[model samples]
Target: MGVQDLLKNLLDWVANLGFWGPAAFIIIYNLATILFVPGSLLTLGAGVVFGVFWGSIYVSIGSVIGATFAFLIGRYFARDWVAKKLENHEQFKAIDQAVGQEGWKIVGLTRLSPIFPFNLLNYAFGLTNVSLKDYFLASWIGMLPGTILYVYVGSLIGSLAQLGMGERSRTSVEWLFYGMGLIVTVIVTIYITKIAQNALNQKIK
Candidate 1:
């Protein structure tokens, strides 16, 4: 099934479980990360089902937990394999050393940068000296803004889906307002992340 269908079915099944439903969704989202699923979709799904406030909360929790789990998996189970693969990787070597001096800042930048590989970075951090607590905190903070932006967009789409666009039809000015808002949000977010990434690269160099 497509992601939306899968999420819709999961939502329906979990809804019948009463108070356990939201918690179950969060757990599922967390576990899905381990499988290398597109967590952005899950975050968007959360916003669709839970609205912006709760969606951001759950996504944050799940993301941090999932990343930490990935870190541990690399540290204990796959360290040897990861090490060998990264042995000749100069970028990997640079990040490792950068993490040594910058700690959470580097981690935070990695989280913000769109070009950074998410799952691999989680594992890569494990080989660094950065503490788990530090990693979690930085990842949480750095990931939050983008999470909010995505969740907000999802919530808007969800609202439109449910309300038939309501007082905001296709020809309405509100549609234009929302369209511009999304475009601006995405551009600003990308710009900021790129700036931060450039600064980080310079620092590491």
Candidate 2:
């Protein structure tokens, strides 16, 4: 199914599950990451289902666990397969070398900047010299900003949907803050990415 349909179905199913919904969402997110599913929709869906704070927390937990799992799979279970798959990825080779020297910094910068594909990078990192502890720590911390921004946007969308249906009320102040927050997040993410990209280039070179 498409992302929206999958998200809609998941929302409908989990909406009635009370406290268990978050757990289920995390598991689903973990599976999606391993399955190579694009996580943008799932992350946004978390905000639509939960709110900003809870959604960010849930997504962070799920994504970190998923990344760790993928890393283990690449390192222990499918090292040869992953190695063969990434052999031609010259960029990954540079990253592997860079990681040997920089360890978690490389992982953190790549995560912050979106310099590499998230799901693939999870597996690819296993081939590097970075420790699993460092990888997990860096991934969680680096991914937080993007997660919060996306979740906030999704929460806003959810609010707008309710507003359209006349099921909820929103104040002008709320809208103002939402707009400002989004703009600030976008700008901050851009600035961070630029710095990360520059630093990563120097390291990889």
Candidate 3:
């Protein structure tokens, strides 16, 4: 089948699962992060289907769980092999040194911004000396704001779609509200990251 047909079939399957379908999808999507699927897509989809509040919660939880799992896999199963394979590469060594010195900070920064890919971090962090508790806590806290923002944006888009095209021009105020919301989200994320970094540094020292 064509890509559109495949997507439709998947959507149908998701619809059949009802509320549980989205939750399941979020979980599975997170679990498969190593496959290079952007977790934001799942969060956005959740928001589109379930509204902002529930969608944000679902994505946050799924991300935490998936990240934890990936960390564990990296710690126990993949670290040695990966290190051996990449040992000759200077860039890889630099990353390793950076993680060793400030793993939590690196993870936190990456999570807060869209700079590095989340899936890669999930696996790469495992190769570091960061404790499981530290990894999970940092991952959850760092990822929360972005997850919420994307989910809420998805919810807004869904509302707009439901209202149809003509309503968009008529609902200029609503669009303004969304723009304001986006601005607020960006500010909040930056503030939260700063606070988190300070707290992490204190703890590390």
Q: What TM-score goes with each of the models? A: 0.72, 0.77, 0.67
Across 55-142, the per-residue lDDT of candidate 1 in tens digits comes to 8998888888898998888888989977986788666666776676667877886676555667777888889889889998998897
Predicted model with the maximum TM-score: 2
Per-residue lDDT of model 2, residues 109-154, tens digit only: 6776544689999999988779999999999998887788777766
lDDT of 3 by residue, 130-168 (tens): 788888888889888778777776677663224223333
Alpha-carbon local distance difference test for all models: 0.72, 0.78, 0.65
What TM-score would candidate 3 get against the native? 0.67
Runs in model 1 with CA error above 4 Å?
Answer: 2-8, 85-90, 159-205
Error of 2 at 20 (Å): 0.6
How many Å off is the CA of 46 in candidate 3? Answer: 0.7
Model 2, residue 75: what's the lDDT? 90
Candidate order by lDDT, decreasing, is: 2, 1, 3
Query: Model 3, 57: alpha-carbon shift in Å?
Result: 0.8
Per candidate, the number of residue pairs that clash is 0, 0, 0
RMSD to the true structure for each prediction, in A, is 6.3, 6.0, 7.0
What's the lDDT for residue 46 in model 2? 76
Residue 163's lDDT within candidate 3 is 24
Worst 10 residues of 2 by lDDT: 159-168
